[model samples]
Target: MNWETLIDEESLALLLPAEYSHFALPIKESLAVFLSRLPQSVQDRLVEEQLALPVDATLSERLGRLAHSCPVLQKLGQILARDQRIAQELRSELAKLESMPSTVPLHSIESILMQELGPLESKSIELLPPAIAEASVAVIIPFREKNKPQQPEGVFKILKPGIVQRLQLELDILTEVGSHLDSRLHDLGIPPLDYQDTFNQVRDKLRCELRLDEEQLHLARAARFFADQIDIAIPELFEHCTPRVTAMERLFGEKVTDHNFTLTTEKQNLAELVARAMIVQPILCKDEQALFHCDPHAGNLFSTNDGRLGILDWSLAGFLGAREREALVQVMLAAICLRPEKIATTLLSLDIRGQCDQALLKECVAIWLRRMREGHMPGLSWLTGLLDEAVKTARLSLSSDLLMFRKSLLTLLGVLSEIGANGFDLDQIVMCEFLRITVMEWPGRWLSSPNSRSFATRLSNLDIAETVLSSPLIAGRYWQAMWQDSIERYAVCANSR
Candidate 1:
């Protein structure tokens, strides 16, 4: 953990692409200044560097290699892959980390299982040769019940040794960076984030993801939430488990990431199923148990043999309360109706961590809506992008869960993009889901609520006849704007090519 040993040439090589090597002196000087200001304990902890690389690799190549060497970096690469804020080319490069990672040794996994399940039960269970899958957090190995070798009945999620400890170290370093940025770099015109708070939220989420016990609970909760949804599958958790080990029913399916997964069903039908699971149903469900799977990356979603969607690894699910749900519904309604004023109002009603200018928020929302009408962006992207811009320009504070929700949408979209299904009309999907919920789901919530005449209820009850009559006019205007936008986008693409 000595600083001198850790910051050697090899360790620093992965910090940037080799073409930028001339900038290394300035980077080193800046780091020296920053490290001088930190406590010795923090500096000592920071001395451990996971990245070791040759000096000639490209940025993407270095990142991919670093991700293989470090779980924390792998997680960062995964996030970067979905981040539209980053350059699309760079994001595309990082997207390689989204694929299955190399697994730890079989002996290491067995030792952990033995520790968790006791030696007897560990021996009783038969782990299939080679892991079924691997990722930043754990290795998934299919297993069979005692004396039943016909097929693997369950899967053991065995946390890699020292993974939790590694993540803890990384979180500590991240928290330090967040604190340093907030305290020392306030004048840098960075966004209005309380980085410490955001880091804390992220740390909590990572901790949850690392805990098999917590994942088990999340799976059960999500299963109950989607119990009535026939097309969704949640693998059942076995009672035999530990904090770092979980036994769950082995879902027989191919991940959407697999090359042959699309062959399970027609592309259009698969697209619909994905949209419903990742977008439509999650947003519109009125049930109190509803939760958002905050990480719907391709690795966590599958196309089952029965032509249904299978959800795996529910480690980072997000819950929205009644008020938050109502606020989101209002925001969606405003965005759909092109009412920026309402969008601003609903956004403000949610949790805000700092002061903000209401006027600036409204103006930003208006501009965002204008862009959306021009078909320049998808619904969720525009919504989150506008919010992010407002946060930077107007110093507006937003909720952590809201940020996670936005991240989930972007992640889902990124996965969809892999199969050229990125062009799915989000507007149409949201509208259909909204109408379906209004007619089929909202009535029960409305009738049971103490205030049946609330604005939400009234909005839901708006006359379908009037909407029907106005449809032609609305459709004409939208299509005209979209056609123009498409032409412009095509021109840009052609020029870029």
Candidate 2:
């Protein structure tokens, strides 16, 4: 884990693409400068041996080593692993990092657990030797209660002994590196960005993962959120739980990425189930605060034997306030209906900090609409692309929660692709969810008093007005798109015949 050893020019050459090798020098210099400011003892601890990189490692292998070196980097790797834009070889290697080998010793884990929750014997908990699973910041050790032999096995998620310190050091290093890069934006030919602010936001979210109490709260909320949905399963919490140790019913299932699991189930059904559980439900839920599972990587998701999607790891979660969710819904509706003006207005409302160019925003929305008309599916990618363009072109500053939600959506898309869910029509799924929400929630929304009407309710009213006003045009566009699709299919059929 020594910064000097793994982040040197030679290692960077192997880890980075040949075209981007020039970035190595600046990166190395930044780390060197940052390390110099730290005390010698601190630096030594930071470089403590964890996982060693192979000397003759391939590009993907080297990347994996770097990711495993730090919790922050491990998370980045998980997100990138699902990204189809990355090289398949590299993605495959990164995917392996999701189920990291247990690096912390059993005795250390035992000591921490004893300190936090007393002796395992006293609590009737039989600690299983050797951790069952390991992730970026914690390890899952399966245990059984002596008194409840008939009950399902439970898991204890123990934080790594020095993870708090290690994570803090890593965040500091990142801040320093980000500051260095931001200062060199002109020389590096990179576009303008609030690198320091972005890193700060990321740091805050990562710190949230360290608080197991908050994670427990998140788990409880998510359980209630999906209580009525039989197809989705959330881990049930046990009586003995603490900030350092979480005891929950062990989820029994195979990773969604397992080929054998996919072979046994209908791919489309499984894919739809995942989409509903991860993306659609969070976006369209009636909750006053929208709760989203920020990390949906392959390892964190499971396909259970009872045909339910088991979601694990609630440490990293995101919430969108009522107004934010309303704005987001409005933007989505505008994009789907091809209303550029509405898209522009909705986006503008979200940019509270900066002055956005109204003209530029509309132009970007129009371009996005053109792509949609050309048969581009309006899923996470299409929506994010539009938002990214708006952020860059109009200098719009969106909320951190919305940005986190976007990142989650992208990760979900990557998971979908990994599980062979890419073949499912995302647009159709989105449309179905939208219609279902409108129908099921409309009555309650209408009955609410005007004084008590939430932002979401007001937005729902606006959405109804806009839809009614533009129904003819929206119907025409859909009809034309359908007609074009039918014609294309007919031509293919004729040619085949």
Candidate 3:
């Protein structure tokens, strides 16, 4: 759309409250700059198309509808929902993009199945009518093997034909917009390549969703990763699954939003189970290289009939390198202690964009830590808000992995809030898990290190009193107490089980 038509002066005023209205000029100029980047023909076409549409609708409403029509906008909406810098009402409006997307006709789905599975095999699986769920990229339909009437049926996920092509077009538009913002909005304090890198990452993730074979493997691997754990369950895939049509055991469960556990204990159990499964495992298993779910929102999680937390949608997953995992530990520790300098330092190091205004970054972090310490209850929104401001003030750019992590963490926190377990403290939960993980890894590390024996001999020769008075000794004692407390709690849970 042309810059003038898209700006919607009234909407702009509402979006940037009166206090920030001074920014309206710059924002409009930025939009104009973006429009100028498009080919004249394309720009004229878009402007004509937008002019033909109804102008009476509010800007937020118009954007919401646009998001529903475009995958790129839907992705942007997901990010907006977690960003505290945006107005809450606007954020909530943007969130509608993620609501049930337009579904494909049944005939279209059947055609896709027939093409992917061949006519004979397609007929072998009795494809049920209508779709169970529809998202921007794909629709899920339940099906059963014709020969195995007694066996349970599974769901087949079929990608909407031509979605990739449509998404590519939208992505191209977004890239142009990003490029213009990068070039024109120098005073906005964003690094030159920030938008380019972010859009590239989004493109990569969208491409990943096109690979159903890879997603199926991720499901199997995740199931294997948590095999020994009794509280988790992953959908079982049928042998006949293919890249375009994946058949997976249908979960007989309700999404967290739909399922009301009601009882306090049940809510607590579900919360703890999710905490261990999502946070603890990923943070602690640096050596094993944990497979982390990038989307753990309420819709993607279910409370199964068998009382286990059923995980769904493994298409978007991230692996934490050892260094990233260690940084996570340090970041959480800093957060728990309300150490702003440490928090700012660890976070800045994670940024891909080189240097930034360190003083400003630390100042922003300190304000957030103070609020959180005083009972504001830090969460995805708070963290993102702080980070967003810091990045704006410092012109720092975050890595793609870190951005995904932010989204995932926000999603996990959203689920936790919905469960409403009283006395839930994410910081404490992370601290306890961090201690347990450290304790579990320490012995193995000591045993494997060749210098351990020599170090122990040298330590034994030191004065016992002096050693006990040392900082390391005090820290060890504190961790030991935490470990013992964790063990006792686990024992209690086991006994209750």
Candidate 4:
């Protein structure tokens, strides 16, 4: 490998998109940085831009980064957001607001406070998960390697539960005294569409809407690597529970949008496996709850040389408590089995709608049901479009809390069909899994883990998650702590980069 060549277009067409052609820079640069410590040939190919434009980094590498950052960030924010002395000091000043006339611009204090706050990021790379004793994963060690980990590029973190009551108190005042904040719009006056742009495009739109430049979007996305740090920057309100942060672990793998080998099926199989692992792991956890790693963008999805699927970024993960998971199981079963009304009924059980919109929800469910039954298998684009539109048009203000479940279902099925890799259909598989789970639950359904072993019995005697409907605090403090860490992870990873 030398400076003369990059991954040729023919091989690249299998993975890279034209729109993402521009993203080649960061990906390439990151790879170069990672490869620089490796053998001269690897260095020549990556650093000298001699390897093909898109080569692959494996999955474990990505996850290792994700897992490491998530915890580190949480640790950082726990120290900062929950610093009672700082809060006590800051809160002491709010009384002064009593002296100002009602018209005084107080929120300007936001800028002043932001200036005073400072945080840090993690150093070096988190290369892989601890070795599992049950299953062995083959590692494709590069010919030359660095003794220390290379940091992820372009990430940042935010404060957790800082000014908890005060911020909300201010937001309430701002909401009541609100002179309409600008509706989200680009200079083109074109509002952003949730479904239209893929991940990267969405970030660009975000930069514009938020008045940031290309560098900022890079910073934000790169922050995905330091997910562990999110909680450190932001603190949760309840001292009993920790806050959450979502972060990304950028993919370090060869992109394969097309199949060139006879074993092409491996790609889809691995992808579906990745998707399944994501769903299964949550249930495996004691709480049956974990952040749904939402972004599965190209840079986010990787097939390292060895072929394990890694999911990155738990930043926007959707968390499901015991009841929520149960409700979700019910809904997923209903959707796959083509029972639209049943799904709607389950949503109603979750109190997804107000009394007035019950009929509309049912009607919408009917529409979705009909599409599932009569139409071709659900397509990702169409489904994403509908999901986005429903939220946008939602007058009743349904929280997008369950969105990741919807996405997990869609993305699992989608990547399979797109690559023609496997017969993986989320609705189909989830339905099957539920039928088994439901049977298993018939007797053990109410059973809880040891930490919360008695919870099911208590819940059986009482309504829990549903009753706490509007709470942003789902899955309690343990999860909140995990979430907070996610943000810190991104922040640290970004700074390290």
lDDT of every predicted structure (CA atoms): 0.66, 0.77, 0.67, 0.35
Better of 1 and 3 by TM-score: 1
Clashes of each: 0, 0, 0, 69
lDDT of 2 by residue, 378-490 (tens): 76568788888887676777777787888887777777777775457766887787776667666776776534426333355655666678877987876776676679779
Ranking by lDDT: 2, 3, 1, 4
Residue-level lDDT tens digits of model 4 in 308-409:
453432233455566666654445444544555666666666544453256666666656645554454543333444344434333222234455455554
After superposing candidate 4 on the true structure, give the runs of residues whose Cα lies further than 4 Å from its correct spot: 1-252, 256-261, 279-288, 313-316, 332-345, 349-356, 368-396, 404-414, 422-424, 435-497
Tens-digit lDDT track for model 1 on 80-195?
67554444555666667665644688888878877788773645777775887877888888787785555448989888787787677666666765675577444543454666
Clashing residue pairs found in predicted model 1: none
- Model 4, CA-based lDDT: 0.35
Q: Top lDDT: which candidate number?
A: 2
Is 2 or 4 the stronger prediction by TM-score? 2
What is the TM-score of each predicted model, taking all chains together? 0.76, 0.84, 0.74, 0.38
Give the clashing residue pairs of candidate 2, or none.
none
Give each prediction's root-mean-square deviation over alpha carbons.
7.2, 6.5, 10.4, 22.3
* Residue 240 of model 4, lDDT score: 11
Residue 226 CA displacement from its true place in model 4, Å: 18
C-alpha lDDT of candidate 1 relative to the true structure: 0.66
Query: For model 2, what is the alpha-carbon lDDT of residue 77?
Result: 85
